[model samples]
Target: MGRRAIVLLVALILAGLAAWAVWNFLDGVRSEAEAEQVQVTVYRAAEPIAEGAEGGILLSGQELIVESTEEQVDLPDDAITTQEELNSVLTGRVAAGPISANAILTRSQWTEVTIDVTPLAELIPSGKQAITIGMDNIGGVNGFVEAGDRVNLIVTLDIAADVIPADFPTLPDQETGGEGATGEAETITVTYTRYVLQGLPVLAVGRNVRLDEDAPTVIDVEPDPTTDPGIEGEPTEEETGNETVFTLEVTPEEAERLAFAFENGSMWMTLVPEDFVEVETSGVIIDTLFGGNLLDDIFQN
Candidate 1:
């Protein structure tokens, strides 16, 4: 070998060794930093953790908040990370079994319970079908219809001379008594509104359950100013909800009849007293608007 070639080979070996040593040193420093133990906050009982206590109950500011051991910890995946996370997902979840004081909390210690998830089907009793009817301000009693309340169902139907039912009666319009025998025969359309189903129980309004018995009567209430009207979803029933539909419990036959009336005509409901009392009356017709003794009701007052 040439003298210069041997020197170059020796230089190359030394440089390679130095580079490998520097890389190894950096890797060791990184591992040491990572291996350094980290302190994680966990909820530890200041006193004996009794059975049935909340798994994620908030600690008083002075409570003995705890940190993970100085020794490296292999915490279970279910270990709660923050007080806020514990409060939100674990609050009110009672301890399924007892836990010892100063012991780290685990998901297994608490019972999983679901809140505010009652389904509409559960509200309907056996042998009855739930029928939902759509309504607006006029038909829905201005958002007064609530679950467990009784309502009187009324139907307003248009009867054309061509398809009028034989059983259904019609009355003449007083104002437009019609060209009795005029050259151009005027077809008089009659509108009859019948109070069909009395004291039907309301099962639900939108997604809300029944109101408390002591809940105050609802009048026409303006939307809460604090409630962001811009925000949208199902509104909180009675709190912020503008209810647009109501479900009623009815027999199969009654449901079929109600569905027919809903498809054919406009249906309305009047909320009756909790003690639903039926009123005696035949259905109202065009004549009843003014032709009946109803005129006396207006004149008398």
Candidate 2:
């Protein structure tokens, strides 16, 4: 080999050794990565676990704590490492069984709760959706409708028969009668209302049942003449026969229609008697209000 060849060969051998050293160093660091200590919070029982209380209730800092442990430590499956995981999840969940004092809480110890599921989710029928609608005093059954009551929803629309421009560009022609379509353009406004949805179970009324707890909340929805529920005997101007919001259970398809109706027009609620059964009726409209008795007296029924 020439001298130049020998120099090149030596340089190549050094570069190979340098590359091997770097590779070996990284391999060693990777091997120790899991063995490195990390600070994490783990649950510890402070007292005897309640029969049905949430697992998180036992997780005060005094009871649970953050400690340094190897990343590869043998953690129980129920181990909670973060506050959000604990609060958002484990906090409201009931224990599946009793937990002994000083026992570490693990994922396996408590019943799992679906995230964002309401406490009253059990009441919602499958294939249905829960939606809220805004209502004034009259639309809310005058504060008589409770959360579990059934109601019918109606919408009132003011349609105006207006003379709009033709679909395509056009101009008035005096030579051809000089009159707008169907005489001079004018709007004939009409007030009409119709039932939109029926047999809807009231899921919530006003702000009282927002939490979806099993029992009706202590927050009184209606005014009482003799009690403090009416805001110090005489209700405040705002609280007397004030507006209430209602949440109802509806089929997914009906939810879309109801949402569209709510946005497009005003809604009224009609409370239905629990004992009364409803037969299918082609909902009432202004055109049918007189039926066959168009000329009958108003009070003749």
Candidate 3:
């Protein structure tokens, strides 16, 4: 071939090699893009999950859903991506806080199970004081009183003549057999039962407490029926413990009254409804109790 023709041929060969190289680079780029677009299986919450709820229960109940989604380029490093990882890491853990529905599961969302005991100070509302009272099963509503419940406190006390005012009028001494006879005053004792505190919020039951007004009480657990007395009418000491402590949220003045009643008078707790309305009570004494129509109404009914 001539020199000019050979130079042209060599130029064509070099151009072809450059084109092949560009094609190979483009194909590699396309492959990498496709790989990055592959779908990945991830876990997400199907329903709202309460804080401290078990992950396994959530998954089994379909509260947590598994979905296949395109791998996100900007996905978080701690995001849960695979079934194996979720089962190993999150199934045994609990949500660190309330998880909204459809939230992507992540390592930071869960934590190891821990006792959820709320501090007593945290439970007391602003401007309220926490006071605890110890009572038997009957007084504690057969161990049914739970934290976050509302209750009324009834106190029974004995009033003696010494506690009565000294200025009160006195009748003539009958034993002296004289009219308007001035002598030592006669002593008398009377028992009265009246409601001391109404609509008091319970702060804690024993050691278990509720975190917030909306949160479920941590100590509200159903008693096991198998352990309850089947044939015996009355529960034994082993079945119902001697005392259950009830922590109540009260004002400073109410706390003082409760302390006095707890110290000197018999106090009983009566669970009140959420919409309970306070009513003026006349209080019960021997005369009022016996003279009222309560007995007649009961027998008539």
Distance from true position, residue 106, model 3, in Å? 22
Better of 1 and 2 by TM-score: 1
Full-model lDDT for every candidate: 0.69, 0.66, 0.76
Across residues 1-301, which tens digit of lDDT does each residue of candidate 1 receive? 9999999999999999999999999999988987786666666655565565544443422353465542326666677667676665556576665566677766677766545444667667799989888988778888877788889889889877654344334455568984333233345677888887888888888876664445455432232222223335554555644587888889899898898898889988898997768887777775587656666777888
TM-score of model number 3: 0.48
Off by over 4 Å in 3: 1-111, 115-117, 162-180, 213-243, 291-301
Counted clashes in each candidate structure: 0, 2, 0
Report the Cα lDDT for residue 230, model 2.
Answer: 23
Q: Write the per-residue lDDT of candidate 3 for residues 128-159, one digit (tens) a residue.
A: 99988889878878877777889999999998
154 Cα displacement, candidate 1 (Å):
1.3
Rank list by lDDT: 3, 1, 2
TM-score of 2: 0.40
The clash tally of candidate 1 reads: 0
lDDT of 2 by residue, 180-282 (tens): 4543456777666777788888887764444455544442223223212223465564455454778898998889989888887889888889875655565
lDDT of 1: 0.69
| Cα-based TM-score, every candidate | 0.48, 0.40, 0.48
Task: Look at candidate 3 and tell me the lDDT of residue 104.
Answer: 81
